[model samples]
Target: MDKKAKALELYLEGFKVVEIAKELGVSQPAVTKMLKQFPEYHQEKERRKKENQEKARQWRNEYKKQKREQYDEDYELVLKSHREDAAALSRRGKLSDDILIKLCILNYDYNKEKERLVFNESAGKRPADLPRSVYVHKNVLKQFRIPTRQ
Candidate 1:
């Protein structure tokens, strides 16, 4: 590389401009002019940045593809196992239909509680004065439901 380019790279690599000028044994203004006059360094920097971005994009795509493949394989295995377990439980008569229904109800309740926790956390400090009936949906609509007395 040219002395000017080498000096410029050194300066860009964190050496002070004055130090680079002193090392190159050129006047400070001369070094500055040399750096400014060369467009190759700027082009190289832009090219490196673009290359890094492309590499990052490729890495992300590969990661997403691998994750999706693993997810599908795990999903298939889980669904297969779940169906097999449900069938075995059914044939064994281990769970009364009533107990199974209660288990399902418990699961639904757990999920609702978890979702409510996330919703509340995202909403920050909820105003105590806000009505209990209000809800925000994925479609960006506000829903207000009135409670019916049993």
Candidate 2:
């Protein structure tokens, strides 16, 4: 094969210009010069790079979608189980104030952790219509070392 054709082939196979040059028994600059002689080679390489990037982005979006669906399904199951347990305790007359308080604290901690994750993922952009009072409440909770709910 001609040097240009060989270089193009190697380049398409994800070889660096230096490697292509070495394989073709030419200098790196010579390889670059040969590639420059064919503008179509550069165009095709760019097109392939974009195509690969688009495929990766699509895959990432699909993965996120699947994860969200799974999370929603699991969350619903857990919520139902929690409600059933609460109802059973209430029917047996075992749901005391202490138990209720503990449950409240557990729910609060779970919500706070979820909020922190969301805040971090949003890069610190506050949600719309968030009350100023809630910010003050959070500061107060922080001062008291009490975790706030999401």
Q: TM-score per candidate, in order?
A: 0.40, 0.46
State the C-alpha lDDT per candidate.
Answer: 0.60, 0.65
Candidate 1 residue 21 Cα shift, in angstroms, is 12
Off by over 4 Å in 1: 5-36, 89-150
lDDT of 1 at 81: 91
lDDT of 2 by residue, 43-136 (tens): 8779888989999999999999999999999999999999988786876676644444334332222124322211222334443433211112
| Candidate 2 to native Cα RMSD, angstroms | 16.3
TM-score of structure candidate 2? 0.46
lDDT of residue 117 for candidate 1: 12
Strongest candidate by TM-score: 2
Expressed as tens digits, the lDDT of each residue in 4-65 for candidate 1 is 77876886676656898889888888877777766855665567779889999999999999
